[model samples]
Target chain A: MGQFILFLVLMTLGYLFGHYAEKKHYKSINKREKELLKLPVISCKNPIGNDTVAHVKLSYGSVVISVDYFKRILASLYNFFGGNIRSYETLLDRARREAILRLKESTTDADQIINLRIETSSIYKGNGNSIGSVEVLAYGTAIYFEKNEPT
Target chain B: MLMSNIEIIPNKTIVTGFGVVSGSTVRAKHAGRDLMAGLKNIFGGELKGYTELLEESREEAIKRMISQAEQMGANAIVNVRFSTSSVAAGAAEIYVYGTAVTVE
Candidate 1:
């Protein structure tokens, strides 16, 4: 009976807190995504023009986000069912997008960003029970085109 | 030395390839930073400590990789890539690899 009550309490706490966090995160992501629609980052092998005068530099963005307890419980349940555990997907998605947004935000002088790369790491600290957090890193080489002089 | 993840430098000439060079490191979160990050997590924002830890790890790996490239008589590294994995509980591994090349 004691264990049951404790479980109920954890679940309730997780539900309220998790829902609030998720909603706020989604709202922020949507707003930033809309604002950042102009600066597109891509991964391609070749540069479109043979311009050597452009300034080239690297840009990096790192994001560390935690998985809430409520989704952790739902995910473990899904794990037992032997199917896709979609709860963690949003967490990773948010991390990735946030990283990219950060990279873009820092590149005001960049004309285009290419050779993009992304890396992810999971921070697991629970006692074989759940994953605690996730970290994602997004990076790219940003090129700034220098003004061309008329020949 | 110059390093870029792209296959070729936008305008520089790559003289020769010295094959692949790589460097990696594993880091475990300390108790204090973990506790502070835990508190920060309650507010649902960026955990600066963890970010700095991973950033430091990445810099170290890249530096080692660059030193290796230099040892190979290469002035540039191209097609560089980075990857990370959870090696153990509270620990993570950062790996950086790229093709070493001599550029003109």
Candidate 2:
């Protein structure tokens, strides 16, 4: 009976906390994503214009995210049932978005961002108990065009 | 030195090439963050704690690379690239590299 009560308590606490974190993250991610739409990160590898000073530099954004215990319970149950563990889907989504936002933040001076690439890897990859932590990295070569022409 | 990942910069004369310059650093998270993160894991979301740790390390690596290029007397660094690796538990390494060039 004591163990059952403890399990209930943990599940409730985990649920509340997990829900709160996910909401806050989505709010922040959506806000930045809306702003990034204006700048438009591209993977074209080359920009249209010439006659400007350009610099090839690396900019990257990365996020390490994990799933909450409540979701973990659901995920493990699903695992035993041999079906999709939906809990992790959004975890990856948030990481990817956050990484892109960070990349954008780093290259505010650049006019166009070309040659963008995203790499995803599991940092902890869990210990078979739950999904631990995953990192999503977005990297790009940023080129800034010099506005004034050289004589 | 001016550093860029772009293949070429317009309107500048490439005087000479000094080859690639690189820097790397390894960093570990503090015990406080690790404990706090363990608690936060119950509710789970963005580990802002770890993010900040890696950000600082990566920036430090970039600074070191730039300084190395400066020491070589290059005006700019181009074709920069970064790589990250986890060298140990709770620690990750950030590396930045680029080509040094004299631009006129």
Model 1's CAPRI class is: acceptable
The TM-scores, one per candidate, come to 0.83, 0.82
DockQ, Cα level, model 2: 0.51
Model 1: per-residue Cα lDDT over B39-83, one tens digit each:
544334456788888889988999899999999999888888888
Candidate 2 DockQ category?
A: medium
* Per-residue lDDT value at B53 in model 2: 84
Query: Candidate 1 chain B: worst 10 consecutive residues by lDDT?
Result: B38-47
Among all candidates shown, the one with the greatest TM-score: 1
Model 1 CA lDDT for position A15: 70
Cα lDDT, all candidates: 0.78, 0.77
Model 2 Cα shift for residue B79 (angstroms) = 2.8
lDDT of 2 by residue, B13-104 (tens): 78999998999999888899988777667768878898888778878998898888889899888777777777876788877787899988
lDDT of 1 by residue, A1-151 (tens): 9999987877777677777877888899899989888677887755456665455666778888876666778888998887877877887888899889888887756777787888777765554856677788898887766673222
Which pairs clash in model 2?
A56-B4, A56-B5, A56-B6, A57-B4, A57-B5, B2-B76, B2-B77
